[model samples]
Each structure stands twice: as C-alpha cells, then as structure tokens.
Target: MTAEATTRAAELKQAQAALQQGRFAEGLAMARALVQDDPGDGEALYLAAVAARYLKDYEAAEDWLSKLHRAMPEYGRAWQEAGHLALARGREAEALAAFVRATRFNPALEASWREQARLLAAAGRAAEAAMARRQQERLARLPRELVAVTNHLAEGRLLRAEEICRHYLRTHPRKDANHIEGMRLLAKVGIEFGVLEEAEFLLESAVAFAPDDVQLRLDYIDALRRRQNFAKAHEEAEKLYARDPASPVFRSRLAIESMAVGDYERGLELFDAVLQQHPRDPANLTSKGHALKTTGAREAAIAAYRAAIAAKPDHGDAWYALANLKTYRFGEDELAAMKEQAARPDLSFMDRVHIAFALGKAHEDREEYAASFAAYDEGNALKRAQTRYSADAMSAELARQKAVCTRDLFEARAGSGHDAPDPIFILGLPRAGSTLLEQILASHSQIDGTLELPDILALAHRLRGRRVGENRYPDVLRELTADQLAKFGRDFIENTRIHRAGAPFFIDKMPNNFRHIGLIHLILPNAKIIDARRDPMDCCFSGFKQLFAEGQEFTYGLREMGRYYADYVALMDHWDEVLPGKVLRVRHEDVLDDLEGQTRRMLDHVGLPFEEACLDFHRTSRAVRTASSEQVRQPLNRKGQGAWKPFEPWLGELKEALGDLAPREI
Candidate 1:
C-alpha cells in the first residue's frame, strides 16, 4: 500500500478504537480527517456521523449524513446511519423514512428490519409496525422453543415464559447469548404486560448483570417510575446523569423525576442546565417555562415560553405557557398572537385545544363573546375526540376510588361540627365551566379564588396502601379513624390556606372535585357543592380532546368516555341519594340561558347575598387555569351549549354509546 493509504487506514483504526473507548471528540477529529482523504468511503462518513451523534452534535451529524446520502444514494449503511441520527434528534418521521430506505437498499439487513419494527411500534403506526414485523419474520427463522416462548409471552401466557426462562437460566448457569436474550425477553414481557413487580425484579437483575448498559439502566428507571418509587428513580437518574452529564435525554429524565416529586426548584435548575447545552430544545424550554410559572416567576416564564416558540415555531406547549402567563401578566399585543396560534389548523389535537382555550380566554378578556365561544367550541371538540378514543373501564374504577376517598374524607370531618375552611367546592368534568363558577363565586367578596389545589387527591393517594382494583376503597377508608381524618382535613386546609389569603371563604374549584363530593359533604356538611353539569356529549367530547396528566384515559375512546361519564353521573346521583340536599346541580346551558337567575340561585345556595358582581362574573380579575378561562371573561352565551352540532354528523358512534348529545342525567 502507498504511504498515504497506509496512514489513512491506521488513522481510521485508531478512530474506531477511540470511539469504542468513549473518546468521542478525539474519534470525531480523526474520523473527519480519514473521511476528507477517502471521500468516497461510506464507512468513513458513517463513522463520522456516529461520532457526531455520540457528541450530541445533531447539526454536524445531519450535515455529514446528508453529504453521505448525496454521494452514495444507494448505500444501506449511510441510510442506517441517517436513521440513527434522525431518531437521536427526535425526528420520528425522518427516522422512519430513512429506515425504510435502508431496508430497501439492503433487504438482508436483519438488524435494520428489527430497528424499523421497533421505531414504527414506538411511533404508534401499528400497520407500519406490522409490515416491519413481517420483514423480520421473512428474514430469518428462530428456534421452535424461542418462537413458542415469544408467542406465549405475546399472548400474555407469562407463566410459560417464566418457566422457560427459569429452565434456561438453570441449565445455562451463565450469561450466554441465549441466556441474555431470554432475560431480555423476560423484561420485555413484564413491561408489555404491566407486570410491575416482575418487571422491577427482572430489570434490577438485568442492570446488575449489565451495569454498563445505558438501555438497561433506562429500562430500570422506567419500571421504578411506573411503580412511583420516585426517590429510587431520582437516584438512578442522577447516577445516569453522572455517567453522561452532557446527555440532554438523561438530564430531562432527571428533571422530570424531580418535578414528579414536587421538587420544583431542583427540576427548574436541571431544565435550565439542559437548555444551556441545547438552547433550541423546545421541550426543555417549555418545561422550564412551566416550572417558572408554577414557582411564581410569571414574567420570566413568559419570556422563556416566547424563546421556546422562537426556537420551535410549532411548539404547542410554548403557546399554552404564553397563554397562561398572560393570565396575570395581561398584554393586548400578545393576545393577537395567542389567538392566531390557537386557531392554527396544522397544530396537533392537544395543541389545538391548548391554543384555543388560551385564545378563548384572551378574547373573553376583550369581551369578544362570539370569538371567545368559537375558540372554546374548537378546544372542546378536540377534548371530545380524545375522550372518544381513550376512556375505558379504568376511568369508572378510578371514579369509584375517588368517591370512596370522598366518603372516608367526609366521615372524618363529620365530628368537627365546623366545615373545613374554604368548604365550598366546584366539581365536575374538566372544561365543564367549573372555572367560570369559581370566577363568579370569587366575585362575591366573600369567596377567594384558589386555582385547582390537588391537595385532596394528594392526601387520598398518600393514605392508600398496597392495594389495587375497585374494592380497595372501603378497606382503605376503614383504616382512617376520626382523629386521623380531622388531622388530614386540617392538613389540607393548611396547605391550601396560602391560596385563601385570609378570605372568609375560598373556592377550591378542582373540576375533578366531583370525585370527592362525598368527602366534601362529610367533612363540611354545610359546604356548598355545585355540580357543574354541561351537555354530556359536549363535556365528554371536550374531555376527549384534552391531554391531561392523569385520570383521562376515558377521553381517548367514545365507548369508555360514555360509560365513564355515566358512572360519574351514577356516583354523583348516589351521593345526592345518600347525603340528600347536599349537591346543587348547575347546568351549563341553564347558566347560559338565564345568567341572572342562575347567578342568584348559585349565590343563594351558597348562603351568599345576590350581589351585582356575581351577575358580572365575566369582569372578575382572577386568573383561571381551566379551558374555560376565555369564556368566563365574557358575558354568558349559548354558543357553547349546543357546540356538538358542527361535529354532530361524525359523533354517531358516541351517540350510540350515550344515546344523543342532549344534556342528560342518569
């Protein structure tokens, strides 16, 4: 070989060795030098891109891969490298397209097909996933035992997979390739089946056996997070971050875990650190903005949100954050931008809801009732679509659990004689005008407006022990004695007292408070319970469109949403039956139809005088976090009452489930 060729070969070998040893910067320098000498070499360019990706230099990786693709369009390795680069940068569509190209170029690439299937499944394109699965099936045949065990696991015949894995472990007695694969299969089955305990144990064992495996550590973190072992998850995340401090993915994971455990300060710091390295990361920017908003840095939060939008024009969460920030830091110029973004048809369903909801509030603030109602209608429609697809038996079960939580809660309060401070609660399905009711009540001078405090739900979750399923409530309640219940109630009051700010009364307007009405009645027998009832179709459909953090699976499926809504009504009816004269049902339509009459009745029910301010609730200066923020800023209108009309033609499936769009009670 010539001297130049020999030197290039030597440098390429050294680069590969450097990369293997995690000396990414050193490897990248050498790889680029080798690539410059051998521009036609696909392997060199691929290695350069891999090094760039490892260094988290997404732009460099993209540039390198783009040139490689241009130079050798049919090169399977270039396509595969591009796919990896795309996935690393969170470009799923680009990744899938590249993977498709790779498979086309080299049909014999078994690993490429496997990765293609995994990516498609992750993206929720089940048909595409099935196609990739077929490719894997056609490429190679597995041993009968492996195939049989995999099939059994897929079918949730876990005992068989366990037996096979155990036998394999016993016979192998070492981490052979087959044994490792079996363990991996075991972990996969556990995760897919939601077998938390088994998944946790298997992941722990896997991590122990392969401590250096990043993927294994990630899997273990996922299992622990699912189990709500936040402390352990945070520790694992910290350890992972220490291994790769510059990895935005690991940093984000740590931030998320910290936020989950109410460590908002630490979460914000971590998020800020992530943004420092990746200033254009829209997700990190949005998260940081949200953390700021929650931590009371309202103006700074708005600025961060704007920065996020500037970086990623289509970042919906940034739009939502800006809209929320405008609540206390109102701006007329920003309103137009908020409205425009909220109405963008190209936005995703959840983004559309957020934008619409924000725009609605902004329009309402300007007293543009027609525009506000239109925004609300669009937002509500998105929520309905979500409920149609996601809600199921799980919602019913959750609602039941919530009701039991309420019962035990109230039973504890029964002996106090005095209702807990801020006894008035507004509860119903979210987007059902609970916020509007709170705004109206807050205008009463007697009531303070506290945006949804999750104190009650948090308290209930804390009281729960090692039990699952529907029947766990009664047994759980039996464990809370009167004294303990009073202490719990007192604790709830103390936590929320900050929001009350010395007001004689405050509206704890958590829409999900419907789940805790039983507790509300028992704790404060005299506490007014306003059940904000909207048209079932409108409410359920609106819920479907919303992307809530919890208790919203029913919103994803029409049948599930319908049944869940029915159960919610049934349980509320039961509360009314057992408690008698406690709940005052306030129809959204009725509130719209006769604002004065409804306002008077609402005030009277809560033992307040009929003040003119109650009639002018739209002018109240309180910050609302609910989707109704916009609508409540305007005078009452019927535009939202029959909102299901435009989408009425497409809601046949839902109509069949709930038997019409008209308001109904079980």
Candidate 2:
C-alpha cells in the first residue's frame, strides 16, 4: 500500500480498537474527524454510528446511520444499528423490522437474527421465532473470519473481502468447513465480477469435494446459469428438486431454469404450484410475468404484474416491469402511488432506481418530455455512480482487438475451427435492430430463436485470465493450435444445444458479441453473422431512455453512448475491410420500408430459400426476451424511427460525440 493509504488504515484501526475497548468518547471524536475529512467513507460513518450509540446519543447515531444507509444501502451494520436504536426507544415492532432487514441484507449478522428471534418470541409468534433461531444457529456454525468476509462482500468492499477469503482458503486445509465456505465466498465474488467460468470451476471443485452439500450445489447451479450453461444448470436444478420436492425455493429455481431453456409450459406449471403455496410472492409473480411476456401472452403478463403490485404496493420491480412493456400505459392513480413510494426515505436503493425508471417511462408515454428526461437522468446517475465502467478503457480494449485481429492473423488461422454451419450470430449495440432481425429469422422454418447467450463473452473472459493488467485474450488467439480452436467451437455448440429446438440453425442475438467477432470467426468458421444497424441518433437516444437489466453501462450517459456507437462503427468498418463478404449489414429503416425485400435479402445472404412467413414475423409465436419484445410482436412501422426528436433539445452531447457519424436529420 502507499504511505498515505497505510497511514489512513492505521488511524482507522486505532479508532476501531478504541470502540472495542469501550472508549466511546475517544472513538466518537476520532470517527467524527475521519468523517469530516471524507463524508463518503462508509467504514468511518459506521464507526461513528457505533460510538454514538454506545454513548446513548440515539439521535446522533441515527443521523450517522441514515447517511450511511443512503450512501451504502447494503451495509448490514447500519441496519443493525438502526434496530438497536429502535429497541432503545421502546419500539419493538420497528426494531424487529430493522433486524429483519439487517439479516436479509447480510445473513452473516448473527446478532440481528438472535434479536429477531427474541422479538418474535415476545410477540408470541412461535413459528417465526423458531425460524429466526434456526437461522442464527446456522450462521453461528461459520467461522468469525468468514462472517467478516461476508459482511465486507455485502458492503461492496470486494477487494478486502477477496483478500480475506483467499487468505483463509490458502491457510486452511481443503476438507475443513471453513475452507469450503471460503471457496463459496470467493466464487460469489467471481460471479459479481462477471467471471462466471471461474466461479463455476470453484463451486464445481467444492461440490466434488463434498457432493452432498446442498448449498454448494445451489451455488453451482447459479454459477452454471450465469455462465449460460443452461443444460448443466437444469441438471443441477433437477437434482436439487428431487432431494426436496416440497421446497418452494428449489421448485422456483427449477422453474426458472425451465423457462430459461424454453420449456415454457413446464415452467408455468411449476410457478403455479409455488403460487398455490405462497400466493402473494412478488418475486414469483414477476417471474411469471416475464415468462408470459416472452411467450407473447400480453394480457396474462399484465395481470401478473398487477397482481404483484396488489401483493406489495412498494414493489418497484413490478412497476418497472409494467413500464418496460412499452405498450403498457400507467393510470394516474398508479403514477401517483409510484411517486409517493419513490419519495420515501426508507426505500431500498434498487427500489428507488426502479421507481425512477418506471416514472421516466410513464412520463415519456404522457409526452412530458422534460419530466421524462429528469427521471431518466436521475435513475441513470444513481446507477452510473454504482458502476465501475470507463469509456476510455472500453475504447482501449477495442483498439487492442483492431491491433491484434489483423488480416495476416486471419489468413494464418483460416479454415480452422469446428465446421459448424448451424449458427447465426445477430450482434450490435443493445438498442440496435438485432431483436427485430432475430424475430424475422426465427419465423423461418429452419431457424430457432434463443436468448442473448453469453458463451462467447464468457470464453473471452476465460482467455483473459484472472489478472487485470495483462492482455491475454486476442494475443492468446495467436498461440492457439487449430485443434484447440476447433475444440472451443465444438464446446460452444454443445453447451448451447439445450436452448435449441430441432431446427437446422439457431440465432444467438447477444448484442455485446459484436466485441468478440474475431473470436467468433476463429471458433465457428462457418457461422453466419448479421450486423444489425440503426440510425445513430435513434439508437443512442433509445438506449439512453431505456434501463437495461445488466451490462450496457455506456448507455447511462449520452456522450458515452454516442462515442461507443462511433467506436462500434469504426471497428465494424475495419472488420469489413479485413473479413470482407463475411458479415451482412442490415439497416433498420430499410427493413421497415421493404419488409419482404429485406427479409428475402437476409434469407439469401444466409443461403436459405425465401419464405413468405419471414414477412409476417409478427404472427410468429415464440419466446422473445428483449426490450423490443412487445414492439416486435406487432407489425413493422415508422413510429419508432425518429423517437429522438422529442428530446432533441438535450441531445447536443450525443450529437457532438457522434461527430460526422450523426444523422443529418431527425
């Protein structure tokens, strides 16, 4: 560590020691000084709250905790302190609620769980008290160091959590319980960092060591799903369900896996069974809505969303789901209720983000352009602050790809890789026309539509290795033998088989796959690629207005989106120059103007016979999982072609970023 950082750490350690030794006054003074130096320091704020609470200054303690909670909602210690303050004020119910939230945010909080059990028992709630006691007992089995690691992980101190977890794993024996827990914690950190292959490997090794460990199996299944290894994930989910057929959690997980693998009927059946036992479950209701929406069951999806809202009025996800439908309009009462809930100080950070996006959509539908932009800006600002995205870094990575994947490299590795002619890749920016293209192609008799699979991205991450400062991926491609490239292609095809029906070809419409086009070429030499293009202004603004479920952090800002789009165009142009006649570029406006002609052109490019059904893509009934799901289910129109006009006043940054690439007219 640097000298300044070492000094700060020493001071924080001294303050912590003072608090531990009951020197509340001294600790409070020290913590206050630290907070004054940096108000955003979560650890310092937590120490101040702890010291004030011990000094019997409940108001000051709460003030500190409120700031901490606002800044870091996932900090379980803040919630625990709030619970203690509530109990001191003789508000047992409020204390119970706070403790429940504390434990929910961080299951390692054994004291919160014990207090929850005590409060439940005092309230004569025997069943809840027993459950809380069981939770506390289960947590008590974990080592104190592991519990601290969990606390740090929950509070977003990932580096510290990772350091402690790795130290534990290195020091402890393999078969020890603490070692197993350390593996799970480290795997969790990997998952959060988007290193799904590493997480899958860690959990797989841990599960092999203890095959009967249920939690380890569950974590493994989750890792599999994150890796887009849906077949393996389904197998693990089935095993878990067989072990306990009556478990709602297991059943729900199995149903989600089923839905992911395109077994919609079976998924809905399992979801219904779970709802029979817990009718007011907002999460299951939302999942059910997702399944219904993807399967083109519009009315049923709306009903499910409404039911979720009825169950929990502050369910911001349900509200956001409704707004995300694009076709759905919110009533005045619903809008008012969402605003009230959004304005509450006690709402969770994620919930507030959802409400802000939902309100933005609601206002946009009402043509309140200024209000819509404000809400969108607020939501994006909140989300952007939490992300670690850097536009310059992304640009640099793209530059590396351009530098590495040269014409000579392609010539040297030409004619290698698995001879898989059954894959079609539809890739581009997120708000581009990829989904519409997928829908059109899926209407063909020989094509199967799949979700945005992450196999290529995961492979890129794996090749990059665990370390940061090394550029191992595109450079590593040069060292791979022909057999290795073929094996990778074969593995990708085998892994994605679970999402495919009995079709001759399948579409992988992952937008981010555009970044790995060279990787795709090296792996699947015979695969077809379609570059889905849209008008730059419409595409960037549409992405700016929308809130994606994950990734696409660039869309949080207009300049970022525009610059990213410009880089994308530049890289794609380079690809065309190096890999000519390989990618078919389809324009969104041309497709809308001449649906049949464009459809026929696309089919011909893929070496398929022209089919009339491609023109009637809206009538095709299948799972559509994208922001444009509802829009694609309807006939083509120019309604969305110039959507950026209404918000043109605030799009100068986007236009300036696009430079010469910006559209001349709306």
Candidate 3:
C-alpha cells in the first residue's frame, strides 16, 4: 500500500477503537479530521454520526447522517442511526419507517428488526410485530461469527464472509451446532457467489447432519431450486408440506415449487387452499397471478393481480407483475396510484424500483416514449447499483473461453462424454428469441420444454472452485479425465430429469450458455446446439427494458447489453469455425417471415420429424416462464421487429458499442 493510504487506514482504525472505547470526544475529533481529508469517506461520516449521537449532539449527528445518506442511500447502518435519532426525538412513526428501511437494505441487522418489532407492537400491529420478532429471533440464534458473516454478506463483502465461515468450520467440531451454522453460512456465500453446486452439496450435508432441522431442510430445498434440480426441490418441498400440511407457509412454498416444475393445476389448487385460509394475503395472490400467467390464463392472472392490489394497494410487485405481462395496460387511476407510491419517501427501494418499471410499461403502452425511457432508465439504474456485475470482467471471461477452447482442445476431448444426446441447447443472448424457438421445439411431440436450467452454468462455477481470485474453468477443462467429463454429462442429465416429461429430448434454453459451449461440447458431445440470433438493436434494447426476475445483470445498461451481445456473436462465430456445422443458427426475423420453413429446419437439425403442431406452437398448453411469456403465447407478428425506433434518441451508448454491428437504420 501507499504510505498515505497506510496512514489513513491506521487513523481510521484508531478512530474506530476510540469509539469502541467510548472516548466520544476523541473519536469525534478523529472522524472530523478524516472527513475533512475526504468528505465522501462513508466510514468517517458514519463514525462521526455515531460519536455525535453518543455525545448527545443531536444536530451534529443529523448533519453527519444526512451526508452519509446522500452519499450512500442503501447503507443500512445510516438508516439504523436515523431510526435511533427519530426514536430519541419521540417520532415513533418516523423511527418505525427508518427501521423498516434499515432492515429492507440489510436484513442481517438484528437491532433494526428488534426495534421494528417493538415499534410495531406499540402501534398495535400485532401480526407485523410478530413477523419482525421472528426475523430478529432468527438472527439472534446465529453464533457471533455467523452473524458477522451475515453482515458482511449483506454489505457485499462475500470474501470476508467466506473467510469467517471457513474459519468457523475449520475450528468447530463436525455435526455440531457451530459447525452446522458455519456450513449454512458458507453455503449462503456460495449461493450469493453463483456457485450453486457447492451450495447444494453443503446444504444437503448440513441437512443430513441435522435431519430434523426445518430451516436447514428449507435451505437445502432453495439450493436445489437454484441449481434447477426441480425434482429434488419438489421432493423436499413435499416433505416440508407433509410435516405441516396446515401451515400456509409450507403449502405456499410447495405450490411455488409445483409451478416451477410445470404442475400448474396442482400449484393452482395449493394456492387456492392457502388463499382460503388467508384470504387477504397479497403475496399469495401475486404468486397465484404468476401461476395463472405462466399457464396462459391471462385474464385470470390479471384478476389475481387486481385482487392482490385490492388486498394491499401499495403492493408494488403486483403492479409490476401486471406490467411484466407485456400486454396488460394500466388504467388511469392505477397509473396515478402507482406514481403516488413511487414518489413516497418511505417506500422500500425494491418497491420503488417495481413501481418505476411498472410506470415505464404504462407509459410505453400509451406511446409516451420519453416518459417510458426515463422510468425505465431510473429502474435500471437502481437495479444496476445493487449488482456486482462487471461488463469488462464478463468480456474477459468470454475471451478466456475462446482462448482455451481451441480446436485442439475439443479434438483431444472428442467422443469422451456421455453419449445420451437427450439435450438440445438453445443458447444465445437474452431477449434474442431463444424462448420463441424453445416454444416451437417444445410443441413437437418428442421434445420437452423446460425453464432456463442452470446445470451447465452451475457445473462451470463448481469447476472454478470457491476462491475469489480465480479463472479455473475452461482452463480446468484441460485437466479433466474422460471419465470425469462423462460423469459430469451424466450428472447434468440425471439432475435435470425432474423438469422433464417422457419426451426423448428436452430443451435447455439458458441464453448465457453461449459462453460455455466448449464445456457443453466436452461433456455432452452429442447434444444438439441451436444458436438463437436476433437484430442487435432490437435484442439489446428489449433486454435493457426488461426487468428479469434474476440473473442477466448485464441487461441493466445499454452498453453492457450491446457489448455482451457482440461478445456472444464473436464466441458463436468461433464455435462455428472450430466445430463446423455442429450448431444450427436460427435468426428470429427469419422465423417471423417464414415460421413453417424455420420450424422444419430446426426439427430437421434435431433429427425430428416435421409436425404441423410446431407451427402452431402458440396454441400449445405448456407453462412459459419468461418475460416474453405473453408475447410467445400469441402467433408470430411484426410488432416487435423495430420496437427500438421510439427510444432511438437515447440509444447512443448501445449504437456506439455495436459500431459496425449497429442496425443500419434507427
């Protein structure tokens, strides 16, 4: 480190020590000096606020906290301090709101949850108070080290959290309480790091060690779901439900899992039972709306969303869910109500984000392109700030794949994997018509349609190990034995069997799988690969405007989306060169112009017979789980062909990123 940086760090530590020692005056002086050196030093500002609050200098505390809030709106500690300030001033409502905000930003804050519970009880809101108490109790049960891990994880310090978790695991006895806690914490870090396989293994081991631990089992189920091992997730969910058949929470979880695995009728029935027991539950109503929407029951889904709104007018998710249908139009009153909620200072950050996206969709439906773009931009900005995604890092990763996955590497590993050939990978950038293609293929009698399964991505992440600074994936492929590759291939098929019906082939339409084609080829050499292509402008713009439920963090910015699309194209071209004629490229526009011909081509590529049902894919009765769920449920149209024209004025970043790849016309 530089001399100045070392000195600054030492000084900050000294200031923190003074505060911990209750030397308020000395701590305040040090904090002020630090702030003077760098006004935007968030730690210094936070320390100053804490010291001033301890010294009973209310005005000074308020000033420091205001600066901290301005610099870091999502900083939960600042909001917690603000709550304390309000409480000291006897503003119970303001204190409650601040505490709620603090917990929303960082749920690991046990103090905030306790304070919220107390305030809710005082306000006579018994149900909410009980919920808050439960949350606080959950945190309180964790060991100090795990609590620290949770705090670090909440603050986006995954490496620090993992370090603490690993230390605890190494020091604690196996199968003991502390060790189980450590395992859970480490598994959480894995999930956050996108290493789902490791998380699944850890949670499964933890659950086996403590078979009766309900929370451990629940965590296992979640990990299974994240890895897209739907069968196991469903099995675990059923066990949880069987343990407490009358528990609405358990029933709700099982219902969601059922919907995930395409048991729509059973899911709807379970949701109905939950609604019967708790008629005013907005979350359950919203979930029911999702099940209905995915099953192509648009009107029923709309009614469910409206019911959720009626149960709780400020339910931002319901509003956003309706907007996400891509065809639902908000009424004037609904739009005004959404705007009011969006403008509320006390609204949760996620709620405000949902309202912003909903308003964006509302404006777009009315052809108010400027308003739509502004709202969409605001929503994307908020979501982007919370994500740890780096476009440059992603580009570097893709570049590494190209460098390592040479023809020689593939030729060396040729014919070494499982020979099942039951998987068809429709891979490309999101919003690039993969879902449309999947819908068509799924319409065929021999192919089963599934959600974007994470098996390939999870395997890739597992191979990278748990270290923070490592790129051990495509390079590690060189070290794998033929038997290991075959095992991985077999594991992928066996794990994904939960999402399959009795079809001979199933489609794995994860768009990000484009970056892992070499790994796919190495493990599942006989797999059918289809490249879903689209107009760059239309595809990137569509992705930017869509708020995906999870992943696809690259879509939050126009430049990131464009650059990712370009990277995808370059990698796919490399694959074409190295594995010639192995992957069939399906342009979305070609499908729009000639659905029958492209349908036949895709079926022929997969060695399936031509079927009239493939052309009538929209008429199929399967669950579609994507942003384009509504759009894909209808027949092909020219509606989205040039959808980016209206927002052309603000697309300079995307256009510049695309360069020669940019569409000829705006």
Candidate 4:
C-alpha cells in the first residue's frame, strides 16, 4: 500500500529471481541492501544467508545468521540455520550444539527437532533418535494429524502414514512449510515402500524446496547410501564433516565410505582414531578390528576385539570377531589360549554363544568333528532359546518375499534377449569370504571389485513394487525386452563406474545377490556367477557371531543362519542344474587348500590370466571390509575347512539340520 513498501517488494522479487539463477553475488548485494533498510527483517537476513551459502562464503552466511539470532535470540530458525551452515562446513560437534540450541529455543519447531533426530541417526545414536522422534510426537496435539501419522510410523504402518501425509499435502496446497513436512513424510513412506528411486526423488525435491534444511540434507544422504551411491554419499558426508570437524560421526561415516571404496587403510586409521576419542565405541572398535584383519595383523585385530568385548562384555560382534580370528587366523596355541579366555565364567550368554560357535568351527576345520559338535551344541542351546524372531512367522514372511522377488526377476525376464554384463556376481552367506574372493578377482588386471552393491535389489524393486526381501512381484510373465535390459544394463554400468573407477571389469559382489540369481541369469546369460561357498558350518557359525549394521538378517540366530544357508545352497544347486556352466562353484576350502590352484581356476572362469598377485592376495594390500578381511591378508589356510568340529558337542539343533559336511572333492 505504501510507496516505499512497493519498491522494496519489487527489489525482493528481482533479488529472488537472481538467486534462482544462481547469481549469488548480485542477489546477496540486493539482500544486504534490503536488510540494511530493515535490520529487523528476518526474511531478508535469511535470503542473504542463502546467497552467502551459495557463494561458499560460510563466514558471511554465519554473520547474517548471527545478526538474525542477536535480533531474536529465541528465533529457532536462526539457530537451525547456524546448525545447517555448520554442518555444511563439516563441523558436527558445533552443528550438534546449534541444533540442540534451536530445539531448546523452540521445541515447537518440528523441523529443527527432526534435524536433530536426523543428525543423531546419521551418527548412529539410535536411542537418541528415538527420543527425538517421541518428542516430536509428544509436542503435537492429538486428534492431531501429525500425531496419528507419526503413531502409524512408529507402529510400522508406513502406508497409512503416507496416505495421510499425501492427503494433507493435497488439502493444504499452498503452505510451503507444511508442504515440506508432507514431502518429508512421503520420503519416509518411500523408504518403507522399498522404492529407493522414489524415496530419492521425493527427498531430492524436498531438498530443492528447503535447500538449507539440515534434516532434508541428512535424508538425502541416507537415500544415497541406500541406493549404494557411496561415492556421492561420501561427497555429501564430506560436506557434513566439514560442518563439524570434531564430530565422531563425520569420521565414522568417512571410514565407512572409505572402506566401501576400497580405501581400507585410511578407513582403518580413521576408525581407530574415533575409537581412541570415544574409547567405548563398539562399532568403531569392531570396524577397526576389521581393518586390522584386512591388513593381516591377526593378533592386533584380536586385541581390538578383546578390548571391545572388555568395554562391552555383551558385544556380540566383538565376541564373533575374536572367535573368527582364533579359528581362522591364529595358530593352534593361540586358538587354545583364546578359547580358554572365552570359556571364562564371567562371559555373558551371547559371548558364550559366539565363543562356542567359533570354537566349533575351529575344531571342525581341524577335522575334530566330535569337538566341533560339542561347541556347536553349547551354542545351539542359547541360540534356539533366543526369541529374536518367531520362526514360523519368519518362515512365512521369507517365503512370501522369495516368491515375489523370484516372480519379478524370473518371469519379468523369461524370454527376453537381454544380455547381462560380465555378471561377475559373488554370492554366498555373509562372513563367508565373499569379499576376499572379490578382492582377489578385482586385483587381477581385468577385474574391478565394486563394493557390495544394491543395484540388483534396486532394479528388482523398480520392476516389482517391492524390495528384494518383500513379496510383491506380479504372477504373470513379462520378460524384459532386450532393449530395456540394454538400457538398464548400461545405466547400471554407468552408475557403478564410481566403484570401479579404473578397472576393465567390475564386480557386483552383494553376497545376498544369490537370491537374485534367476533375475541375473535372465538379464545377463553370459554373466559369470561365482558361487563363493565356504564350508556350511563355517559360514553359518561365522555369521552367528558377528554384528552387522546393515542387511544381515539371517545372522541373528543359528537356525536362521543355517536355514538361510540351506536355502542358498538349494537355490545355487538349482542354478547349476538349470543354467549349468552359467554358474561356477568356488569352494572356500579348495581356495584355501591350494591357493595357486584355486586362483588359476578362478581367473580362468572369470576370463582372466593368472597373475602371481592373485596367489599372494594377502600382499595385494587393498583395504578389505569384510569379516574375512584378516583371513585374506594371509595365505590360504586349511584351518577353516572343518572348523565346526570343536563345537559339535554343543550343536544339538543344527547338527541334524546340516546332517553331514559335503566331501572336500573340490
């Protein structure tokens, strides 16, 4: 209405247009002029900060935000923006402090609350994350839509919450703040939908609307990690790390991505440093152990595991790692000493279980079946009694998931002429040396060991309306057309190029990729499917003792691990029967029995020449990030062959399940 106000509004519009076109300097100049005229204007300060951030002038952005905060100390957005800019510059500790300050200033700021939760989750502070989520729910009034939606989320009613969020967005069309909330909810829904691409798209849009929103930034990072875009995820994490240099979270994440990208040594050092700063950090300690194992420092790795166990006696992963080292990497005397230590009465039930599992495998490897049975029997008692899952329900759910994935992968590509890539899929149960095999192959001149990828799972999700673990595929057949497969194949190749930045052949070594063998075969008939089979008991017991942060569902129980392995074997056998030479069986025992022989055969199968380095895979020195990291750093060993024997006396349940060891004819 006023002449001056109209002129200011026009200038603001022009400034916004310039900002939209990324003319940061010009837009920032306009924003400063507007703010100078009205120092109390929050919007002008916000715009100036945005422009400063765009120009990579973090100090300027902070100055603008500080002015806003000084003007209104209780201004929650100001604190939130301070956190955002801090996080953007990789200052986690400061970011955390800022976010906490924002939430303290205004608990009603749901966005700020979620940002804290997101950062906590990114930092692996699950309990803190839960607390934040609960606080968000508590602050909302009931019969309140947000309460109902969040309650549904808490109860795993993802679809209901999603529908509600979508409905809210549709009804409240013009509110940018509410719209952003709706998008955030939709992204969560997409995660539950197991649609990585959809989740990715929704979150990407959410970030576009609120580019400086810390929670949205974190959500974007998670989506990237889920899609197995480690390179990009690491890049985003680098920004976050810059925001909080002292934050252990940044180091931990960098370590994880470094490991993923085959920078094990750097990852190890970072993990070790994090553990040093936060001495009782179980995950960092475990990861550090893995790095040690990878570097062939078996004893040192074991010490780390032991220290982790000492810090947290019930630490399942530490126990598992200790056992693995004793059985696979240690000498007979060291094995005896370690087992004696594990058998101490002070050990927790989980530790005992892990020890038994490890001891059994060790005995079995020494061909002492009776001793192995004893250890397995002891471990089995605790395992069978554990109520981690209801067996019948899990069976049904797993069967349903398998059926859906099978239909999607098999029928959808039944008669299609899609020629798959090298399809060098390394499949087996986790902790069964799949990563070692990949590293060996990858070290070869022709092969690239791409990290544990989720491409097949992502592709499967897109094809069916579900994830690899969910049953949602159509019953009817609809083979992928050759052109479609070609496009998908090329996209897959291009997308995964980051993993194999400089290799001729790339490996998609998702161990669980075993479940998608049918789909893989259909897509890439010529693809070399390397069935990386360790001894059944070794694989089963190994998985049982470790702790995995992601995607080792079968590892929580002995029966579950055993049954999954059985299913995997059955499936691989079917592939052998149906596709014949399309699959090559790489027995871990044989690989150990004569490393050179196995290496030569492995190379021949993958269509590569035998390089001496393949024989000395231990000396290759690339960072390995698997349970077998330590084992691979040494020459092959016979000690792992029948390692289940010592615990055989304890394996009352699994003994029947796995009736006999398949003869070592390989």
Q: lDDT values of the candidates? A: 0.69, 0.90, 0.90, 0.70
Top-TM-score structure, candidate number: 2
Per-residue lDDT of model 2, residues 524-619, tens digit only: 999999999999999999898888888899999989999999999999998898899889999999998888888888898888998889888999
508-547 per-residue lDDT for model 3 (tens digits)? 9999888899999999999999999999999999899888
TM-score against truth, every candidate: 0.52, 0.95, 0.90, 0.62
> What residue runs in model 2 are displaced by over 4 Å at the alpha carbon?
1-39, 466-470, 664-666
**Better-scoring candidate (TM-score), 1 or 3:** 3
Q: Which tens-of-lDDT digit does each residue in 1-666 have in candidate 4?
A: 699889988988888898999898999999999998999776688789888988889999988987776445545557777888987899987888788877765555566677778889988999998888777664553325655565466445576887787788788764554677677767777776566787888888888888777678788888888887788777876777788767798888778777666677778878877877999888788778777776677778878887886676556567667656644443587457547766553344455666677676667567677776667666665555443345455455445445544533554555553454555888877877787788788778777666678887777667665342454432321444667766766677667777675766778878877766665665566677787888787777667655454556566666666667766776666666555577778888777677778778877887877887666666775645565665666666665555555555554445455555433334
The parts of candidate 3 lying over 4 Å away from their true place are 1-74, 93-110, 113-143, 311-314, 466-468
Model 1 lDDT per residue over 279-320, tens place? 888888888877666555567877888888778665667776
- Ranking of predictions according to TM-score: 2, 3, 4, 1
Candidate 3 has a TM-score of 0.90
Q: How high a TM-score does candidate 4 get?
A: 0.62
